[model samples]
Target: MLSTAARQAHILAKSRVPAANFGLAARRFASSQVQNEASKEDKATAVPSPEDLAKASHLPHISNVEMPNKDINLKNKLEKPDYEKEGYQVPEWKKAFGETFVSLFHIDMDNVRAGTIGGSKYYYMCKDQGLQFTDEELSETAVFWYDTLGLPRTFAMWFQITTLHVWLLFVRMRAMPFKMGKNYQQKLVDKLFKDIEMRLSEEMNVLSGQIRDSYMKDFHSQMLGMIFSLDEAFAQKSDDVLAAAVWRNVFNGDKNIDIVKLEAVVRYIRMQLYVLDSISDRAFGFGDFEFVGPNETVDLLTAEDKAQLLKMTKMKFEPEDGKTLPSQKSKLSLDE
Candidate 1:
């Protein structure tokens, strides 16, 4: 029976009779079957809208995916950028900027390694673009390594380097508080941070992990020992003890920092105070006597005190009458 139908179909290859057009008739038959199946499916399923049809047309074509509404794609935007096509570039100036910024904050992230050229460096390159620090940064509260050097890409890097620097300084000052006391140790601390700045200026462009790798060298070990020693002391302290030690002054005061990352956070605040002090010194050229040791004492002068200090330094004295002074001096006791 099958052979008989095949023979009949083969006879239709002559194209003489209406059903003899084998190729054309087969195409018509296939079209009718497709239409019948499509009709059955349409009956079973609801009608698809124009949008759904358009999406289906593009389903397998990954090259041209439509922007699936903002609300749905929010996750993609918040996450990392599409570097494959968008191209994550590390401009020379931006790299230079990171080097300079890290120099100021005391870390040479350029030399640090996050894996590949396009890996960590590229990640940091983008992060450094729109990086933002926490509230502590705006308040100039602590060391502010995040705001200063974290570079949005590697949030941990800035904290790690800055925290290490501060922890070491803290250790040096801690033992000295008993031996040399706060006044002496603090000044030394200031000099230490200053030297860290010099270190940054010297090697701010090194890759990530690069510094940590070479940190076992003689000089690196010395510095690393200082940093480690400070960390160990802090670690030895009870949580409550550590918090109270570094944060007592700033805690529950007119100024308070978010205490999530207590140790590193506290250091961040201190770094900020150091920066503000630098700014003040720059704004007003101080005499050598006014510039004391780093931790010795901040001219934690109030705004009014700062103005008074600046004015006094200018040798601008006013007599009782506020008149012009003589070549030598003006006596406040002079009559109007």
Candidate 2:
């Protein structure tokens, strides 16, 4: 009923109210969306305080934690001496003369030095002792190694066997009194290493200095690993553990290793260790020890049988009614 201009103005006014309401509604929705996103971000990055973190179910209990002692003195207290400090000092003149004599003959000084204990009458006693395995014993063991483990009679095989025997002796040596045990162990280890070095150059013709050095480093690392494996196995006193160690280190982790042969080796080791354990310390140190013959069944031997075998194998140290024979001391003096 109004004029056209008034009618148009009224419609425009009504349209403005709806548009403003729509804008308000849109702003509210947008604000709600922004708030929801902010809440999510807050939840995602939330960091709890120390007290709250302690109360969290996923964390380990603080009281159950064990911390290592950081004190140097405490750490040092666990270390043991590797050798005797006393009774190893020689006269300067004698030491000089011995060194000269050793050098002149192209003798490996390391072996001599390791075996020497001040003025000990029996220098190179460890080398002279020479593993104490009889020819037959050696041959039989070699056959077993070759046949059972498929090891060829190469230097590598020799090294493994020699290391194995040395490890057995080392185990026995550890049972000795601390100073004596350490001295014997060091001497034997030194001799073994020096001999291996010599064989590499002489027999194996590994003449390159660099190559020899690299091989020696590898050998040292292998020795450490073997020692750790053996120690762990022996400590556990489990046949399965020992067999696994032997298979891994000695057999080079052969996938088709004969379980029976491996068991035989374990038994052999136990038997040898037993025999060595029964020997007198003096005999062991003086190089009078001998291994059981290869034909001898170590595992089958009863305690009485072992006692009798020990008696038979016992080395006679009597020098024909106390007659004074020329000792290593006399020989060294003669060389000088």
Candidate 3:
């Protein structure tokens, strides 16, 4: 068998073909309350119980799905937000104060937790099946990883899958303007380590913080290497190079790797990148993008469709007579 480096080199050499051949089309919260003005009012209402208080507030949905084959409603449940954007009803004075503060401080509050929220919610979608499903009821991408590729269902394998998807996002982020791109990358990486640490403790049963930290360091190193390798392949604009990178990093360089499955994965990656390239930087930064289902095909948007999207986005963010809060104001364009 060829050495690992030699194998990678061979794959890259074979990938001298332009990337175009790979079919890279272009394209919350809340509530509470309390009672009373005086003893008469308090006696009349009796300080609403905790249950009553909870019933009064419309809390956001939080997923409780954990085990395999048990998350029958995972897709449907994920469509709801963890925190609602409306219903906060800040006072006009406070809104004005916030607007002043934001202007004075020059804070871009619009994207404040974009990375934290977006990464935690969406990036996990890349390999969520391992956590949500077992071998019995796998998702489309899960089937590709576990059934088609015959990879073991272990945390290591899951990391490989998640990392591959993360790298695909990185490609799109790299195309973004530098400051925004850097912030998104940093926040996403921060969230990744945070989640990994939790998984290592809970799932892997590391028990000891020192040991978990050591494992984290190792994974961090591995991620850096994968990013570098994938970045190089993307720069080369060669599907072959991309395939080689996926083979080495995602498929673990399995000598028995199924070439057909590998090609499908390459196609999947290309398809995702095309969708990412087609989105506006504002839409992505604000956490508006979702990964296309593994089996879904994305038809290129026509000029009319693009125009309609811009119109809808503007209506959502900048309604003509709507009372958009200053905190919600964003300089990002809807048309872009």
Candidate 4:
């Protein structure tokens, strides 16, 4: 039996499909060859060890964060913020000028990720963690889901893991002020499906548009169901409830799942929400939110630190002379 590290390396190598770059004619030819290679590799690989079955974030690669004591209930650790009550106001000047600038340049601050190369900033935030990985690279968050949690590296598994992160972000976005939050959610969802479609065609080699459309429909339904369950758990504001939701969806109801691993996931979700809650509307609107690493900790921001951050933001966006070009004109505040 291979060690956890060796197993991951072997699995990644065997399953690693070369990114599709060939024309339609070439891709049709390469698909069978790729499948044959995968089959050969499958026959050559060894089964995972019993230790692997028992493990979840038990290894050093999983995270530096220590697991909770068996007696400790994670329910007390979860924090749910009331975004409606705590929501910040968007200034009229900012809206009027921001809209004018957007009309001229076709940039919507509310959905700035749409302006990004591959979709919204939020898309990358959700993706980089787990959904997207290559033969040569596995993201830190990917390690957490795949290595730490001992999940299979199939496309369906990827979707399950990615959906969990996306749902967590949705929690934050839904808590945001209505109009802006809705726009952000729509843009992120649009980009997510767009990428999924592309991957189905290019990465998964589903050349049939009809088949891909069916998969999309199925995925859309799953996404909605996952969101509904997660939202209900979140509303309940109990870590145990949230963990059960994670177990049902992300872990796929694995009866053998380690309780410590479940607790880690719950802890991770709460930490992310806490960070999102800490961010201001202006900062997040401008694409400032990032997932903290599973092994890392975020210190509470002090009043002086926030003041300095705002000062720096203003220096970067606003000019000293106050004479801005029409294309560059923006009334979005550096401080919100």
Candidate 5:
């Protein structure tokens, strides 16, 4: 009903109201979005309170600390050389030549006796495994030991193998609870090292007393290194880590090592560890222990054989009504 110009102006006014409202709504939306993003950023950057850190600190068996040189004893009287006085310094060239051609005069009788005792004990322990080695088996073991470790069938090889077996036993002993385990471990270690020292002194018989002392010191260091490395490998729970540890320590870092043989060794170690772990504490404490034969293949172990290996505990016999009865029944059937 209005004039054309008036109608156009009215239409424009109505459109302007919506456009203004839309712009204001957009602005409000953007402002809300900005606020939301800011809140998100604040949350992302939030730090835990001291109370939270304190609570975390109470977690059991969680530690990031490490000890240095705790295993090495510089002040041990056994480690000290009889010839080298405190603050005495020998020329490098003289020390080397002297060690190469020095005369051997006296042997430590005390160390010799201790070593004989320890070596005999270790031999008996291996013998108790009931492994009746045939001539062929003995030859094979000798070859394997020499080829893998670059050592001949000598006293050195004997000691090395003995030490390895002892170390495996030591690993199981570590799982034992309380000071009883610690005491046993200490005694074994002491005997093992004393035997090693005696062997170095008597069998190897280096010319220089200083050189013999040096070799003993070096061997002690190597043992410590092996222990720590094995501990780390076991802790990782990875086959790769364990294999590497075996290659390093047992193979003596030989680059041209046989992969198949190395794998066999790895399997052997794992199987042994599992068997050792399955043994009851009472049985282990009573000196009832055994090792698999060197020629035994873990791959060929049947389920029954595996079960038998796990059952290291001896059967308890009770006399009832003049008849001996077994206290606990074995899960393994005798037919196997």
Candidate 6:
């Protein structure tokens, strides 16, 4: 048998135990990454490839990709977004359909109509950087470990949960006006917003067609059931399939879009499509959003319907019309 030194040498060949491969630490790191990647590739409701979509009438619909606690840091990529002009050889409606979807955040769509810095640049930056699902999510992660989880605002900071914890002092004891403070939470939100931009852009471009056809025009019955069933666990697939499709299209040289701009353009459109999807979803169902049906291109879920209808029973009420409202025992009441 090999002596202890020889055995140690064999294990070292795998890499230093203290450095690279450390049992469960390695597994957690590796498996978490695999989970993120695999989840992205295998859609709970997989969107068909463009080739498949062209040939099949009944392609599996786009399902939601759920969120996970931790994720992988995909390689950093830098690219712009893409959009079609009127004269492109592809069907106008197909292109139009692709372009028409909206986003969930209704910040100010009109503010960023084009794919410029003020518009979709944010998405491009995150997508290319491969930013994480969010900052809190990103810190443990990060595309390049350099970009937009951008260096912290301060070289020094702290997390204070309780006074006792503070006294234990993981952070510096000094509190001076001359130094930067710890705003990990806001920094986190800002970073998360960047990630959101990347995800939106990538998804918009990948599933642009679906966004226009199923989501923007209106939420269909299939989407409703699929989305209704999806918790955070299955939502990323929706983003992945869409993102994959966009990459496929962009790679094929189908549009005049700048390769660098693809991410930004996609991010911008994704944000827009998300809002439209939310509006459409809220139309037929309760809560902030809903999934009405399979992507059949319906318009039943309009903004008007959403604003007017509160309950599935078709109950309607003026803002302050409490007398006509359901009782305190009402299960669907938002007040509850």
Pick the TM-score winner: 3
Question: 1 or 5, which is superior by lDDT?
Answer: 5
Residue-pair clashes, model 6: 48
Clashes of each: 26, 0, 2, 2, 0, 48
Which pairs of residues collide in model 4? 113-120, 113-121
lDDT of 2 by residue, 214-308 (tens): 88888877777887887787776666787788888776787866565565556556545544554554344544344443323222234573354
Better of 2 and 5 by TM-score: 2
The local distance difference test score of each candidate is 0.30, 0.46, 0.57, 0.57, 0.44, 0.26
Better of 1 and 3 by TM-score: 3
Model 2 ranges off by over 4 Å: 1-138, 299-336
Q: lDDT: which is higher, 4 or 6? A: 4
lDDT of 5 at 221: 76
Tens digits of per-residue lDDT for model 6 on 24-67?
22223323333433244343433322122222332222222332
Judging by lDDT, tell me the better candidate of 3 and 5. Answer: 3
Residue pairs clashing, model 3: 28-83, 28-84
Better of 2 and 4 by lDDT: 4
Q: How accurate is candidate 4 locally (lDDT)?
A: 0.57
C-alpha lDDT of candidate 2 relative to the true structure: 0.46
lDDT (Cα, tens digit) per residue for candidate 5, span 1-336: 111211111111111111110112222322333343334554454332212222233222211112112112322422334332337686888766654443233333223322332233433453223211122133444433443323334443354455566667667656665454565566667766664565455435555778877877877777777777776766766667766877887655668765555565555565456445544544444343455434432122235633543332222212244442121211222111
lDDT (Cα) of model 5? 0.44
**RMSD to native for every prediction?**
35.2, 36.3, 18.7, 18.8, 32.7, 26.6
